[model samples]
Target chain A: NGTLVVAEHTNEKLVPITLNTITAASKLGEVTCLVAGSQCAKVAEEISKVQGVKKILLADNEVYKGFLPESLTPLLVAAQNQFKFTHILAGATAMGKSLIPRVAAKLDVSPVSDIIGINDTDTFVRTIYAGNAIQTVKSKDSVKLITVRGTAFEAAQVEGGSGATEQAPTVDVKNELSEFVSQELTKSDRPELTSARTVVSGGRGMKNGDNFKLLYDLADKMNAAVGASRAAVDAGFVPNDMQVGQTGKIVAPDLYIAVGISGAIQHLAGMKDSKVIVAINKDPEAPIFQVADYGLVADLFKAVPEMTDAMNK
Target chain B: MNPFDEIAVEEAVRMKEKKLATEIVAISCGPQQCQETLRTALAMGVDRAIHVLVDPKDYEGLQPIHVSKIIANAAKEEKADIVLLGKQAIDDDCNQTGQMTAALLDWPQATFASKVEKTNGDLQVIREIDGGLETIKVKVPAVLTADLRLNEPRYATLPNIMKAKKKPLASKKPSDYGVDMTPRQEIVSVEDPPVRQAGQKVENVDDLVGKLKDAGLV
Candidate 1:
């Protein structure tokens, strides 16, 4: 009755989200982390040290280099047949979002997605309507497939475990359907938005992309990630990847500083779980102030630079 | 009827207008009210519509797997070279139909497409990945899901609406496609999220910084 956690990683290193997924998987039962990628032995080795994981299943092959769902789904189905595991879980990252549903469909089971809490082995809680409503779903299927929201769970410690590592039988499932082409990512030295301890986000009130420089300076001072609301992204003040909201990334950083954000409900859905929230907006009636731990009503142009100077001092 | 679907339909029509496609068929699975949604697509320049009729109540809990099975069957029946859909429906927010449909049909898929272009018969799809954009090229007879930035859907004019009334609309049942509508998951309960507590106001940046420092957050 152990759970299989689908590990997320770049070829070089395991992603922090996988640690969170492992933490969620531990709540179900004994945890077995599955590291599927081309030359992922290092990743499997790293996962074996995670506190809650009991075993590591390594599937190394060239077919898995890109993490395409078409190729990965068959591997999962094959893994399930061999292990006969009761639960399969992954973090609700981009790769998980693309992979889990297809696997669930192929297995002829319903997939509970973006779950925030686990009531039992079969019952889970997730939000809907952009966090306005929370729904608790119970899976009647014999095998439960789930994608846990990373922000909702604490990450498992990466040390003090000696889980056994074993090689999974290779399954050849060729998908001529799609091929991996190319990727253009925004390489940044700052922490990822969802995993950052401190985050500084801008909204449409930033006025222009250039104005984000203020946020970047403040973020550098705090060693924080920079994020934006949908308004800022739509207004072309920032890239879509920087957007943090219902339709973007969900983050629960320890400290979240909202600069010039009016705080639409969609935006709040992504960051409401932060440990401490600070809202800075010109409008005193903004919805963001409702959830902020400390609200400052002032023009952001004046306030942001002053805060940055204070932090610098 | 979903805004994302509307964007998909709009993109298909634009492709047809650009001579990249000769015909655009709009298909939906839901209650009769879905016909109105299809009509809007027809008015926007779809060649016809196929309605897979089901009771609205019965469709309430149908999961993405069932919907993808039905849509894949329809695509096979029509011999579709390309299937387009919204990334995710606002109601369920599953974001799985397109990928599942592609898997069911055993075709290529590109999801969360913000920009799509037809180049030398292959489709160049610029997708919105986790933190940036990735452009992939998939052969024809593929599935592409529209994202928010795809395009602003155009309104159907009154004259186009009148003409749409005359366009062909075929109705069928889920049984026709041999898809079972049974849901595999059950909803135990739905409730509002806990309300956040009210917060205190700070007078200036100095006060705000002090509060953050007091909380040991700065």
Candidate 2:
């Protein structure tokens, strides 16, 4: 069996790509990475230390300056044709969600995305209903292309190992739908929301931008990233970056704090994955309380400051 | 200006620009009425249109995982350099489709595109990230999901609408593409979520805080 891992060229620190590759590879066959950029050979070599990685192929081209799906799609199509992989795996990342289907399309196959767990050789488990339901699927297709969500399995171990890095051929791109414009990421020294262990969220009940500072204070005390209910962001209490919903970031922290929030289906889609959830809202019957491990019926202004003080103490 | 922004009939009319090496085709998939969205691109001057007719109702029960497969299937047939969809459909309100589509295709997918420019054999895609914007240069043939700010979609005049009618629209069956329209995890029904009862509004911060403290919330 053959597997091609689309790896991140960024760093040695663990990312979803490395984790997905190693797990998918360990289950299927020999694992090889398609290191798709510059300054990635080192990272690829480091990934080789993962339990199952056999080799690394670097498809570095001046054309692939950024994460160019247009350029890389052709290369991946070419790689699949050359490698004859039984399965191709990538992270359920922005690139992963956007690009893998093109590869399956070029090969005249279907791509299964956002799969959370692998059951057997051909069976996989994925979450549905915004992580409320888990569905297990067994593919009838001979080859499978999929995007594995990060939390599905444990990350591949990293050690010091060297793997061969080869250049992947360039794709002759024809029509581009849109060009690379710009990207602005939320700057946080703390762990990213999805990977973080704790998260503090706010809602429209927080009222305005100034009130978000309370959530921020509690989050800072807990070293958590401030999250928002869909209403809060949609109501202009904060920017969309802080919004939590099916259309926003999906986070699965160990602890999630819901302050002044009335949970809605849209809002619950983002943070339902927290191991322990605490809801603090004036209304005891708030939807947020339904899913919360701990529910507090009180004014958030008082509860949050006291909680923050308690934590500080 | 983004070639995609304010795409009026003028851009297509002024086609003699030496800088533009290739023509642009707009691809959007959904049920029959989705062609209406192509009007803005047509008015602004898209070369053609690719429409894959799939029932919108089928999406009612399918999750983001299922929709991504459907999008990838439709995108595969277009043969366009880039794939552009709204960051989240106003109806489904699911923002993960773009990223999910990117995953299925194994391509670099950038979401929340506000501006787009072509230079040096790469597309200069301006993406709206957390704080501001980051310029990413991806070669053609990538997927870019559009934000509401990407363009002020123009209204199609009777003439433009008539002209857009002449543009090609091809329909591909999901079965032909070997994709199962039957959702892997289908929902039985939809209902409004439970709501919260009315809450007490304290007179002042002190009283409110004190009440909360007394209520054990503090």
Per-candidate Cα lDDT values, in order, are 0.89, 0.64
In model 1, what is the error at residue B28, expressed in angstroms? 2.1
Instruction: Chain A only: give the TM-score of model 2.
Output: 0.89
- What value of lDDT does candidate 2 attain over all alpha carbons? 0.64
Q: Report the C-alpha lDDT of model 1 over B1-218, residue by residue, as the tens digit.
A: 78889999999999998898889999988888989999999999999999999867668778887889889999999999999999887766778888788878877788888999887878888888886888777878999999878888999999999999999999999889999887677899999898887589999989888888888888
Those runs of model 2 whose alpha carbons end farther than 4 Å from true positions after fitting are A11-17, A160-182, A235-241, B1-84, B87-111, B114-125, B128-133, B136-144, B147-218
Angstrom error at residue B117, model 2:
8.5
What C-alpha lDDT, on a 0 to 100 scale, does residue A15 get in candidate 2? 56
Write the residue-wise lDDT of candidate 1 on A156-209 in tens digits. Answer: 999998899998767876766666777888899998988999999999899999
Q: What are the RMSD figures for all models against the true structure? A: 1.6, 7.7
Candidate 1 clashing pairs? Answer: none
Q: What is the TM-score of chain A in candidate 1?
A: 0.98
User: Reference contacts recovered by each candidate, as fractions?
Assistant: 0.74, 0.17
Model 2 chain B scores worst on lDDT over the 10 consecutive residues at B1-10
